[model samples]
Target: MAVLPIVITGEPVLHTPAAPVTTIDDDLRSLVDDMFETMEAAPGVGLAAPQVGVGLRVFVYGWIDDDDVEHRGVAINPELWLSPLSTAPLHEMAESEGCLSVPGERYPLRRAHRVILRATDLEGEPYEVAAEGWLARIFQHEYDHLDGVLYVDRLDHTNAKTAAKAVKRAGWGTPGLSWMPGVDDLEG
Candidate 1:
């Protein structure tokens, strides 16, 4: 499997909702494998297909729980259910998250503390996961990508304004922007 170049925020594919994966063939399996490799190499907990310029509803995640139980899998054509977000203020360091597409930045955004993720696997079998804590956050973050929503977009007024400035400063916020994981010095 290869580590694909991850597209940046202004890329049209990332801002648009992804298409469903109706066929699970070798090509899809290979894409999943490559996504895993890319996510690992990017040193990110999760990744979505749209981030890699593939407008398909698929994502890969890998995270180890506090008990050291590893959670890793591909979610194809996923349907996610989230608990109501707490109206309480963001916990800053605890709630801040980074996105590979946004690159080199983390912002505090409120999110549900629990979620249920249901989807098919590479083997074309259905499965579900009930998650809380960081794993749940990962699922929500990646799921947002499938819906064409970036974490920065959900940031509060202050952070959102700052993020917009940063995006402009970096010469992003346009199409045809991408970076190779291992090859680029930037990481998010």
Candidate 2:
């Protein structure tokens, strides 16, 4: 597997909803492998296909829980069920979120406290995960990419303005985006 270049914001693919995976063939498996390598190389907790210029409903996640246990997997054509936003913890409201597509930025955005994610693995076998806290947040963030939504789009008015300025200063927001090498060096 090889680490793929991460697509930045301003790319049309990042704003368009991803297509569903029709078959779990070897190519799909290879893509998943590449995604995992890319995510790990970028050293991000999660990544979506759209972030890599692939318009397919696929994502990879690698995170360590509070218990220090590692949890990693791939989700293809995933469906997420979120708890009401009202139930999110008060502390989470102050937490900042970032994305691979929108590099070097983090904004505070309210999200659900829990999520039930259903998707198939590389082999087309179905799986489900019940996540909460940071894990849930990661799932929600990546899931948004499947629908062409970015974390910046969820920011409040003040933070949105701040993000806009930063994005503009970074020379992003154009129709095209640049790719960055070294996953661990990514700011998102």
Choose the strongest candidate by lDDT. 1
**Candidate 1 on 1-188: residue-level lDDT in tens?**
99999999999999999999989999998999999999999989999999999999999999988899999999999999999989887799999999999999888888899999999998899999999989999999999999999999999899999999999999999999999999997863
Instruction: Give the CA lDDT, 0 to 100, for residue 106 in model 1.
Output: 88
Q: Clash pairs of candidate 1?
A: none
Tens digits of per-residue lDDT for model 2, 73-159: 999999999998864444534568888777777777888989999999887799999999888999999999999999998887888
Which candidate has the highest TM-score of all?
1
42 in model 2: Cα distance from truth in Å?
Answer: 1.1
lDDT of each: 0.94, 0.85
Stretches > 4 Å off in candidate 1: none
